[model samples]
Target: MKILSITTATNHLSVALNDDDQVISEKNEQDQRNHSEHLDPMIQDILTENRLSLQDIDRFAVAIGPGSYTGLRIGITTVKMFASILEKEVVGISTLKSLAKGIDQKDSLIIAMLDARNDNYFAGGYFGQALTNVIPDGHYHIDQLLEEIKKFSQENNIDQVVFVGSGIDKHDELVQKLGLNYTYGSESQNELHAGLIGKLAVNEEAIDPDKLLPRYLRRTQAEVDWHKRTGKPFAPDSDYVEEV
Candidate 1:
């Protein structure tokens, strides 16, 4: 099965083409440009160089959210559009999971974090050979996350752990201060290769493209700002708003 994957979920916009579990072609950009323009053409180029087309693809994959809103929207929309026309299956991979995949170790408790501003992060803990199950999802401050980490390790007796992601440096001081058992992802979490995205989605089905949606783990910035100014987010057009 050939799978195409995109990682517009972070600063690094990466794409990859995989044929039967092996990487055939890939592209990655850490630029600030909007993904709307870059994503499609990159896919086209990769396909062209490989002498392939949309018809040759068996599945589509994307890095779902807890990341840049624009990136996530662009990635989800683009993949969904192609999947719809081509009638292909799509899989949504987590940004954290993709980070965890980059690591080559297993004994360490994998702590994957993405900076979410305001001392909060999109973070999760995974501990296993393949990161089977280490923790739940949470929007957490660095302190709160560390607290949970300490508690879980005490109970499970897991001491070897590594933290991966671009957000790690944001809390570098704390991580160093605690002398926690950790190491950053290779390439500094800069290369979010789409190969990993496809790697994680191999078993999933290429379902109704319409069923695909971004895993928006939090509200958009505009929504959050509006809530702060008006004491509520965008109100739905309910009966309360429609009354004459």
Candidate 2:
């Protein structure tokens, strides 16, 4: 089976093509947010380098995110469009889950965190290779996240955790203040990788292209502002109003 995966859920954009044997091609650009500008060219480069086309892929995988909203839209839309055009299977994998899969720590808690700004983050906690969710994935304040981590660790008697993603740098000092043993994920692991996303999506059930959506955990700024102006509570997960 051949899988082509794209990840633009963070500041980085990564693309990978994998066959039954191994990853054939993988490309990454860090500190770049122009996913709409660069993603197509990057995909073409990866496919051309591998002597394959979009039609050659058996499955399409995308990191449907809790990262950058614009990035997620671009990636998910691109993947869905490809799947729609080719009538191929498409799998949407969580950005946090993919980040956790990049960590190879044995029997340790894996915490995936991506910054959401304003002292908030998109976070998930997985334990060991089983990928158990210790703390649920969602937008969280730093203190709330820390409290949950503490509760889970104390309850499970786990001493340390394996932390990964760009949010690690943003909360390094705060995490350290917890006085719990923890290790920072390697620099290579901090960035999103499409190969890892592809591997995780291998056995996932494919959905219709139209059903795929980016997992934005919080309300967009415009939506939040609208609620403030209208005296309506900002409910992100509820039915969204079409922006005019």
Candidate 3:
């Protein structure tokens, strides 16, 4: 299968093109908040280098986030647009899951966090490759998430959970302050990775191309304003607002 995937659910943005045997091309950027500017050229370069057109792609896999709202939107929206035109299968890989894979936390309870700003984060938990407790991919103060993590850890007797993503840096010192056993990882080891996302996504059954989406944990300021303008308490449990 000629699979292509894009992931920008963290500070780093990465794209990958892979074949049934192995990856054929890949691109990534670490400059913070550069997805908007760099994503297009990066995708173009990858495709040009591989000598493949969008029509050649067999599957479209994307990191459906718990990361930057804008970045997640760009990643999913672009993929959805292309896939819709090409009628390709679409796969949604959770941003937290991709972060977990980056750290190879197959044996440990994994907590993947991406900064959601204002001292809040988009966080979720995985119990040894199985998603045990997910926060509905919502936003919460770090402390609130930490409390839940503590409770979950105690109940499961999880000694040391591996943490990754840009969010952890915000609470690194506090993690030690809380006396939590943890380790820090580099950007390459923490952020959502397209190579892994694409490969993993291909194993799943395809969903409607239009159903492809971003898991933005909280409402964007614009969304809030639109909701306020109309009079609706934004759906708390949902992550996406269908594009009009």
Which candidate gets the maximum TM-score versus the true structure? 2
The global Cα lDDT (0 to 1) of model 3 is 0.76
The estimated TM-scores of all candidates read: 0.87, 0.90, 0.84
Q: State the weakest 10-residue window (summed lDDT) of model 1.
A: 235-244
Q: Which digits, one per residue and each the tens of the lDDT, describe model 3 over residues 1-244?
A: 9888888777788999988527777788886977888988888899999888889999888888766777778888888888889988888888877777666655666777777667877777776655555444556688887887788777767767788776577667777765667776675777567887876776767889777777766667798788879997776666653322
- Local lDDT at 181 for model 1: 75
Q: Rank the candidates by lDDT, best first.
A: 2, 1, 3
lDDT (C-alpha, whole model) for all candidates:
0.77, 0.84, 0.76
Q: Against the true structure, candidate 2 has what lDDT?
A: 0.84
Higher-TM-score candidate of 2 and 3: 2
Instruction: Give lDDT tens digits, candidate 1, residues 1-244.
Output: 9999988988788889997678888898877847777888889999999899988998999987667867888998888988888888888887788788777777778887788777777778887766765766556778988887877877888776687876667677787765457677767454577998888889666566787666656666566677788896455631111110
| Ten-residue region with minimum lDDT total, candidate 3 | 235-244
Score residue 5 of candidate 1 by CA lDDT. 92
